[model samples]
Target chain A: DVKVTQSSRYLVKRTGEKVFLECVQDMDHENMFWYRQDPGLGLRLIYFSYDVKMKEKGDIPEGYSVSREKKERFSLILESASTNQTSMYLCASSSPPGQGSSYNEQFFGPGTRLTVL
Target chain B: LAKTTQPISMDSYEGQEVNITCSHNNIATNDYITWYQQFPSQGPRFIIQGYKTKVTNEVASLFIPADRKSSTLSLPRVSLSDTAVYYCLASSSGGYQKVTFGTGTKLQVIP
Candidate 1:
């Protein structure tokens, strides 16, 4: 089975602090994504990486940044954490890009609940 | 990018079939329709995906019309545990880029 593991299940950060959320997948998938889920707003994509050292901004990428230094690891960074950034962050991995014989089904991790105070 | 719209909520009883429809008026020819089911505080799970007419799997089914502007997700013999939010996504690989969760249809199963 493919396993996507997030570094933290919950985290609390002070305002203006630098925050890092790490995600690692055991399977060597090429596509990885970060999304923050908020009530009413639903799940908004933050960033996605199709290959190592390659990244693309998603719908809500203003306050967030992502890194894909290696194929098995992807990281989401908050340059200056704000209170509004508090939400449930989910990490997911998919097979090679455009290879969603089933429309790019993403296998997700449990998620990290971050609270910016 | 094509935009998707779905109902806010729905109600259904156990053992009944539930169908949730989503509208994507600007869908392109190559766009693929996908459905996801999300539980509270958890990430959404992929249910089904269809490009043309009908696609069925062990969990759910997807129905797309010839116009490709709308799609329906049908759940067979839904149980109480099946209560969750269903999201409709339309993507055409590259052109249809943005993926928005625009108010997915939340299904509440009643006993």
Candidate 2:
């Protein structure tokens, strides 16, 4: 079974503080993603990395950044945490789409609910 | 990017069949529609996927029309455990194709 783990299930940070959320997947998948889910906004993509050190900005990448230095690990960074940034952060990993498959299924870790005060 | 949209919520009784619909008007030719179920405090899990026509698995069924502008997920005889947020995703196989998600339909099952 594939396993993805997040560093913390719940986190509290003060305003203007720099925060880091770590994610590691054991399946050695090539694609990793970070998304923030809000009550009415659903899950909006923040950043996705298709390969080591390669990253792309998603629709709502304004207040967040990501790093993927190792194949099994991806990290989401909040440069300066703010109260508005409080939300549930999710990490997911998946292999590249296989032949005859349009979209590869993503395996997600238990989300980290971050509260910025 | 193919943006998918679903209703905010739905309600049903136990043992009743439930159907949730999603729209993806801008779906690309190569894109396929997939559904995911997310329980409270848990990450989403894959439910089903299909390009066109109809496809069925033990858990649910997916129905897509020829135009592929929309799709529906059908759950048979749902139980209380089936209550969840169902998300619709229309995506393709590019190494970096953006996967767009909408505010899934929250299904509540009553006894």
Candidate 3:
């Protein structure tokens, strides 16, 4: 079974402070993604990486950035946190593109709820 | 990415089959249909998907007919634990594809 794990399950930080959320997948998947879930709005993609050191912006990537220094780990960074940024952050991973069914199925971590005060 | 539309919520009883439908009117030819189930306070999990016709897995079934204007997810003998938000995802194939999740159908299974 593939497992995607997040570093923090819950976090609280003051405004203007920098925050980092990490995700690691054991399956050696090539695709990793970060998303934020808000009420009524549903899950919005923040960033995604198809390979190590390669990243792309999703629909909502203004305040967030991502890093993929390794194949099994992906990291999301908030340069300056704010109150409105308080929401659940989710990390996901999938098999490499061109691999079977990777375009659809992505394994997810439990989620990290970050509250930017 | 095709925009999907689904019911806001649904009600069903135990031992009953629940069919939650999602509509994607402008689905592209190469796009594959996917559904995900998300419990409160957790990340969404993959359920079932299909291009056309019926595709059934142990967790649920996906039925997509010709023309692919819509699809239905059938959950048999739903239990209380089965209650969650089911999201219909459609991703366009060819080139760099982007996936957008719908509002999702909130299925509340009752005993």
lDDT, residue A11, candidate 3: 100
RMSD per candidate (Å) reads: 1.7, 1.5, 1.5
Q: What share of the true interface contacts does candidate 3 keep?
A: 0.54
DockQ of each: 0.57, 0.71, 0.60
Off by over 4 Å in 1: A97-100, B93-96
lDDT of model 1 at position A3: 90
What local lDDT does model 2 show for residue A70? 95
Reference contacts recovered by each candidate, as fractions? 0.58, 0.74, 0.54
Report the C-alpha lDDT of model 1 over A1-117, residue by residue, as the tens digit: 769999999999999999999999988888899999888887889999988999999988999999999999999999999999999999998774366465566788989999999
Candidate 1 C-alpha error for residue A48, in Å? 1.4
Highest lDDT among the candidates is held by which one?
A: 2
**What is the full ranking by DockQ, best candidate first?**
2, 3, 1
TM-score of 1: 0.93
Show pairs that collide, candidate 1.
none
Per-residue alpha-carbon lDDT of candidate 2 for residues B35-73, written as tens digits (9 for 90 to 100): 999999999988899999999999999999999999999
- Give the CAPRI class of candidate 1: medium
